[model samples]
Target: MTQTVSIADLMSLSGVTFGTSGARGLVSAMTDRICFAYTCGFLQHLENIGQFAPGSHVAIAGDLRPSSSRIMAACAAAIHHKGGHVDFCGFVPSPAVAAYGFARGIASLMVTGSHIPDDRNGIKFNRNDGEVLKSDELGIRAQNITLPDLFDDEDMLGEPTPLGPLIDVATAYVARYVDAFGTEALRGLRLGIYEHSAVGRDILVRLVEQLGGEAYRLGRSETFIPVDTEAVRPEDQALARQWTSELNLDAILSTDGDSDRPLLADESGTWIRGDILGILCARALGIKAVATPVSCNSAAELSGLFDTVSRTRIGSPFVIEAMNNLINAGQVTVCGYEANGGFLLGAEVRLENTRLSALPTRDAVLPILAALVDARRQDVSLSMLQRQLPARYTFSERLQNYPTAQSRALIAHLEAGSEAEILARLTATFGGIAGEVDGIDLTDGLRIHFAGGDIIHLRPSGNAPELRCYTESDTSERSVANNAKALEVVRDLVIG
Candidate 1:
């Protein structure tokens, strides 16, 4: 007799591990059975919501990981089993999938590990309108469907027909960059690109060269480089330092494995934080209304220039929702990018008579191209532009193994108390409260703002099992010190 797998058992598979932006895990762990069931379930939910139109094409894409193709094949098979047509756009960036979905007016999914090791892979799903929400995950999980085992002959029955080459996607995306900032602006710019297992390496090189810039390819690694632009550790920094010294280029540009997150280094080989890059890109784009995460430093720099500045929870979905609201209300001309430097332009909404609006998703390519254009226009170095921005120190740290329930409880406790009361209580226990915010914005976590422009926000990471602490101040020293102190206080409260 064939054994049946419980829904809970499928969900608990080791392949459902944390990724920089979404779920990822080992290919073997993410069994073909689980992949088919989850994807079919997700599609069923979409159909119930009237999201899946009959004969409406769904764009499918994958990264360069060894297992990515297998996952994509499984996902496509699942879609086919559900009577949905799949348009396979093989080996592309996550943003390209999003763009293809929007442009073609169809739902899509990109199979990728996205900067994780080659041993792992996963999928990012997008509705025709935008990304799948947190609520959608629950609905998808509630879906229960059985499929044949990987070793069974039935596993090969639902093979999907591959869509022809995505030349149009590549052509249109590249053309958008060329049109936005003519080739003249990129003249004489030199970039050292670390093509270390990034899917966008070749496309990025072509992009720079097409716009009259030079690109030097370096370090093509066979193994995946799990580089997070936001959380570059000391060892990654060391690698970057060595590469920059060896190349002696104007800058070094790269992205996470699937090219969803961008990383940039200055001429002197200093890796600029994503938040700083966001500010520079916003200024370059001449956007007056900027929306970014509360964790970013751009608000302080573009305060005077922007008409409306809004802060959201740290995710592209939040930023996109805020941007949509502003667009609908006619409150802003352009939406600002987050610290990760994924610029989503409102103008990109129209292409080939179709209203292709800015996708409410994170993309690494847009901001980098925008910054390059800005640098050429101003005849200044990328680092120089960054230095000219208003100085606001932003520091982020995460405490791993901190239970989400405990973190939520602490946030609730802090929120229930008044600022004065909370400060008083903190002082009575651990010394004095250095600052506070306008009533701990409990929308996502415990965010306290002080009168001196100091801020600390604590929340559990959505993509990881860690509790994250974000602090901002007028100076880097104060930001670091305050973050350390706040983390210590929180730790003592939880552990003691």
Candidate 2:
């Protein structure tokens, strides 16, 4: 047919739009035609920027979701149609194929919806260097792709050519850690790998044993299980406690689908909050400068470990951008982590005998190993080690199905006037919970500081039509309580 498709029009028509991590949509909406056109637009934009060339190679991988394989095949077909070869690093973590593509100076893609349910899927794109930034996304949206007549009227491909030979990226992924931390990093630790359909399940279990840890595989599942690291599921919470006690384990570890964000629980079976775990991991790595989201707990600055702290919007791209700025400003030993617990190394780190190289993308294994090895070196439980940081507990929850336009309106109402007027309005909004407002920050969201030191932050989700609220207090119970109360207030304000 040789049809010319506008990326923006396709996104709106197919309901598959780009998010913080990738282009995600319902499985029904992500047809072969949409996926193929999206991939073409991505490659075309990269070529325009000189990051991709004709006949270059591209790597592809995916999670264990049933829909991922089909979506990945469409992406591979697009690569071949665009004169690029498919490396086909099948069924690997997002970070693994990204590393391979970066090392080989080629573009890459991962077909996964991250922590979202299996009804949805996504394709995460990366350049030769790192993930596609906001500018790259804009470039892709502005691009026009030529579509072939291979797809049916229903936008489905009829058995596209099979992907190429599988490249073993997991071995190199495992070696990345082993080479940096040695084989005996966790010689005396007992760990649990919760293998609930994560693409890297076997790889994580193998890596744990290879690093000298007694590893147990728990809850292995044939079905795709969506695990969100930020908000631990109630059943998963119970499972971690039971696993720790039954296995006499020191810690339990897992990650979200595609194995990018980390999920770690202490000996008490209590899942460590991702932001808190991030602080401990940064400290263990001797990070001198840190870039984190504004919604993350303020423990990074409170710990007094880093020479500089950069607070950014709630996404990896923003954190990466801030990290690059820190490096450009002459600060070394830089790193970044998300509230979801994915850690990014911004520069090389020199340990006593080994050095860890910079990998700017979010990684699950690095922070998991860092925490385990640091705990061993300190001869303390993960709980005790966490207590060494400042006393702050945070809770986050989101109002699903909330309209993004309404969420923006709420924030705008709170920030609609001069400084004093805004303070007066905020006091009116939050005075029932705590006494007057102490201060407010408009960075990425509406964050309010109360007179009594409690904090409330509200922001719209970048990946979905939802409103998220974060509350921080001196104790975990209070933090959770405050969050519930804040959401109640939000509901009352909006629904009424």
Candidate 3:
């Protein structure tokens, strides 16, 4: 028996929704059938767009989460059902599988939850050329798929078949760096790799060793540890410092769950902000034009590093869209980055007979490598190299479990209110921390600019039920203080 299912309806029923990247939800809600149906819709939509065909190959990969393999199996089953070939690129970084798929002009899926906890998971979809943009997501949501009777009544598939033959992408992924920067890119540097169950742990080690750096592996965990680059846990912060000082390392590197977002700490073991890392990486590559989320540190513009700075909504799809515009506007060198330190190169960088091809997706490896190379070239420590940038600093934190509806209602309440009413509400909450609102931006969320140059921006988390708060100030101390103060006020506004 076959049943017609609307993807949009399934999204509501399953509680899995598309976020800044892909469809994410609690693992318990992502039954085998749910994942299968979602994949079918994804494939069918791609087929309609001519990015997929009956006999086309679909690359699949995943992170180290305990539930990821099961999700990948369900996704593979959908590919087989759709009369497509499955190229299982098992247990790799999100970018690795996408790169393989792009090289072959095939679509791909990555089973991951990124920086979220292991109890949650997600599927990141990619078209042949690159990530599935917002329009592609809309097409997928509009799919009315006919799901075959392949599961039990509870929407669970029994005993998934094995995903055959693993495809190795390690060599090519590492080669992408070595070919451009040479095998001795990090020669004479002792780098520490904090491998906390990220799927790309071993691959990162291989990359370091291949680049002629002495790689020190630390904190290799079997249990799933969700290391969010945006919010480095306090324990992880202490651990970085301990390892760097105890081992006398030049720098330390790590990535989030699927390894798209990078975490880099300086010699003193203080983690570098992602946007700060982006500035250094762009400088290393001599990027001319750049696109970044508005939540990123304003120093990206204040530093005067790039010729053009395009600030978009806080998502890679938006950044990619802006990056495309930069390219179309005839900017010779182009790139983009997120507040999470995931760097995206929009154009191939050719410098002095060395060419590095562009992979316009969030990539952890490029920033790690670029920062290392830049620091080495300048004969300065990563911390010293950072000091050269402008002083603007940014910080972000979130109140988890805040209902999405309430978050939207809070923002909408203020936006719909008159100027004085909005100011009264804002000042009632944040008046002590910052003065009256000087400006407001409703681009993606509620961004309030204070008369004192402080900023407080609030938006609902894309994937999870969380209310995110971002703050910016001229000094790091003020930035951190503002973030803490803002979150406290936001909590009261949304919950109180």
lDDT of 2 at 206: 85
Residues 1-496, model 2: lDDT tens digits? 7899899999999889997898998899999999999999999999998987768999999999999989999999999999999999989999999999989899999999999889989999999898888888999999998898898879999887699899999999999898888889889888999999988889899899889888999999999898988777889999999999988999998999999999989998898998998898889888999999988888888888989999998888888899999999998899999989999888889887989888889899988889888988989999998899999998888887888889999998888889999989888888887668989988888999998989999998776678989889889998888888888888889422
Q: What is the lDDT of residue 67 in candidate 1?
A: 79
The TM-score leader among the candidates is: 3
Write down the worst ten-residue block by lDDT for model 3: 487-496
lDDT of 3 by residue, 257-332 (tens): 8999999999999999999999999998999899999888888888888889999998998998999999999998
List the lowest-lDDT window of 10 residues for candidate 2: 487-496
Model 3 Cα RMSD, Å? 1.3
C-alpha positional error of residue 245 in candidate 1 after TM-score superposition, expressed in Å:
3.9
lDDT of each: 0.70, 0.90, 0.90
| Candidate 3 off by > 4 Å | 494-496
Ranking by TM-score: 3, 2, 1
TM-score of 1: 0.84
Cα lDDT of model 1 by residue, 233-267, tens digit: 67767777787777777788888888878888887
lDDT of 2 at 487: 89
